[model samples]
Target: MGTTAYERVLSVAVAALHERDPEQLWPLLAADLPALCGGDALIYKLDNWNESEGTLGLSPGVTAEFTALGDEDMGLLRAGYPLAAHYASGPDRAPVTARRVAGRSWSQSRTAQLLDDLLDVDHVLGIPLPRSTTPVTGCMVYRSGRDFTDDELRLAEQLQPLLTAVEQQRQLLRRLDTPSQEAADVALTPRETTVLLLLGDALTALSIGRRLGISERTVHKHIANIYRKLGTHDRVSTVLHAQRLGLVPTASAARP
Candidate 1:
């Protein structure tokens, strides 16, 4: 892809962050991804984690093109693909290429074998989403005949972080649109929200303390409250869950 294609794709991806309707997010992805990545197909999956129960949620109501293979494909995908194991393991947001994973006995996986027969898929590249945070979302590119060039792979890598941000904001917008009692009960305070905003910016507790005119210990205290309210164990999940609850400020909203 040329600089123009790269720029356009980036613009669309950034726009996806402000998309008013969460449901439109995937259709937008299906329509835009092929042109962006030079791929034959795309798939997106979202995983949600609860303190009580672990969850792997495939975002429903996606357009058929993204899910043309049908719902049963999940079994094949889980059995053959590395998503579950990847989610289970830590350091949550690294991208995994099919080439890197090709050593995983694909021939032995019944689902992978079925997919190969059905799609004639020769190559794939994937990035798990909501970058740098949990609930284990994944986005994958499929090519039927050729391996991804380093350039195309680079493009996927570049877009992964942007789309991860988009997913966070999309979920936030969805929650804001449909007011829920549960979300309401768990909403962060004005102070906690301020701290989370800085956290999303990757600020340290000292920085947040200076910004908020609080001590580092106080910053940590608020963060602990934020985590407990959000049911998140660490900083990244707290930041992401804050984003989902519309507690973190959006990039556009932060600008002058």
Candidate 2:
């Protein structure tokens, strides 16, 4: 069967996102949206567990309000809007409102208020990707003075699966940086393994000692043993080696 326009656009978006370098991804986002929706595109990393402390922009001339949205903004949205929850629950599409309270006024939704305060965005169509659990990593297509049309919304929806796959690949690449557990365990003793596991949970020597019913000095000794076994000089390296060997599951890998 022939591919639809939506399929073609979505394929291109996914390809752009999955590019090895950020240089390639940004251009596709910037150029495609202007042609598709007649408005600029803004991409955010949505890091720090609450959409804070990440880069934001199209190409650098767009002039976004929050280069990185913060915890407070996320909290407000969660408390006042249904968008976050709906996305987490696997909604294919979400609506952006301008007010905190829905059905009260167009001026009540937090999304709308942000648009009014931040940029020239009037209405937004939020097409959430599959991998995004809390509305953190998805595209927010904006119109200066117009609402999204049915065709545009349909196009965005079609892109969701590809967008999700791109995110998964990005996450997988990050995991590659962690140390392997097999490498860590090469010369580690049983006691060192236990210590490494505890350390991976962010436990200090004293805390590990308490948990293992040993003295703090003994915990330190175990950590030293762990480091020697793994051929690492520090706690971070020790834990990284443990992760690579499957000694500890990363948060990303632990997700269902």
Candidate 3:
């Protein structure tokens, strides 16, 4: 793509971030991919960790069929695959991309096989989607019949930061819309709410107990009650939910 095209992509990405909506980001990403590398593109986001679920597409028609491809097609982007794996393992890390694959095996996956039969694509370039301190939340794939040029690779690299910014903005929007457990007006003792707020601030149980002049076991009991009340299974979800309810400040917003 030309410098003008790259500049347009960056402009679109920034605008999408400001909108804080996934739907707005899709067309910009879709348009930029074909310009950067003459190929159809798909964006996928890691959604379910245990099931290894990732969402594909940009908007309503988007699906996770690409990552669900049979093992063969996955090997072409080994670096991308592992990078996603690592991201799923920890959602607080930045995304990584597999710019190039070792061989033509990328053409062998179910998606590739279908594309080959229908459209004749043979090469793949995978770029990870941007994320905050979480595992790779998503990726963008570029598929074409011919090898990518050096210029195309350079352009993709330049676009990485833009993609990351888009991802971070999406995540922030999600957090903002996420409802807090405390917001349900679920009745809790004053001490329980205090404990929940402290947890949201990332205080350890021990530290919470010390601060509240309670025993650690007592703090743990309060946490257990908080989890049950919030229908949360872990600390992270509880804290995120708490923040959504305006019961706590996000880490970035909290007093130092």
Candidate 4:
């Protein structure tokens, strides 16, 4: 990608990282990704195999095409064409194109024809996010005339890590949103709970303030509220108390 395009994608990635709502992540990515990657449209998939189970987010441009599909067509799309089948049984999680996966048989394959007939796209590039093997999580880009280029594939690989970080942030936000016994007992506001989670990471007040885009004084105020709610004096004790309450994941329980 050129410098300008790289900047645009970077800007989107940064905005995604700072988004506090997990549900917004998919829409945000879906909107910008097609243009950035030189594709006509895109979809972000949470799980693709089960008709009733998975979530799908389409780019604004492709929403109508997706909505036009019948129940049976939707079911077939959820089968994830060829890429999901390949990724599920193997460890190669790199981004791949459907044409590349199916090679000379691409035009004759039912999956390819289905996508072409339903979504009006002749090719697809699957960019698998860093997630579980089953259910097939990630974005799929579509363009009509040709497959994605080597440079586009390289760009997808470059983007994998940033996408992973954003997803991780989304998961953390999700946990904070979930109603739990510990959360009910302490009654920490969502923002304060986020601050407390940062405290558990040993971030200074200034660092927490920077992380949340607030002033150090505001961070200190949140810290004070957390201490009072958790009935603790210092950061360590506050974190320890929160951990014991199951408000935050314990050190050992934290994901790598």
The TM-score measured for candidate 2 stands at 0.48
| Residues 112-221, model 2: lDDT tens digits | 67755666665655545544555345555556776666665555665565555444434433333333545543755434555666677688999877655468998888
- Candidate 3 runs further than 4 Å off: 26-28, 47-52, 58-100, 108-111, 118-120, 129-137, 177-256
Judge candidate 1 against the unseen true structure and give its global Cα lDDT, from 0 to 1.
0.61
Off by over 4 Å in 4: 48-52, 178-234, 237-256
TM-scores, all candidates, are 0.56, 0.48, 0.49, 0.72
Across 169-212, the per-residue lDDT of candidate 4 in tens digits comes to: 56666654354776677778656777888888888999887666
Model 1 residue runs over 4 Å out of place are 48-73, 78-80, 130-135, 178-256
lDDT of each: 0.61, 0.54, 0.56, 0.77
Specify the highest-TM-score model's number: 4
Per-residue error for 106 in candidate 1, Å, reads 2.8
Candidate 1 C-alpha error for residue 202, in Å: 17
Point out the higher-scoring one by TM-score: 1 or 4.
4
lDDT of 4 at 24: 88
- Whichever of 1 and 2 has more lDDT, that candidate is 1
Per-residue CA lDDT of candidate 1, range 1-256, in tens? Answer: 5789878887786566445567777667766775587776666665442223332233233334335554565555543265445645776555555656656564456555554665556555666663445556666666666667777777777777667555654554443334356556786654565567678778899987765545999899989998888989998877666656656545455322
Predicted candidate 1, C-alpha RMSD: 11.1
- Give the clash total for candidate 1: 0
Cα lDDT over the full model 3: 0.56
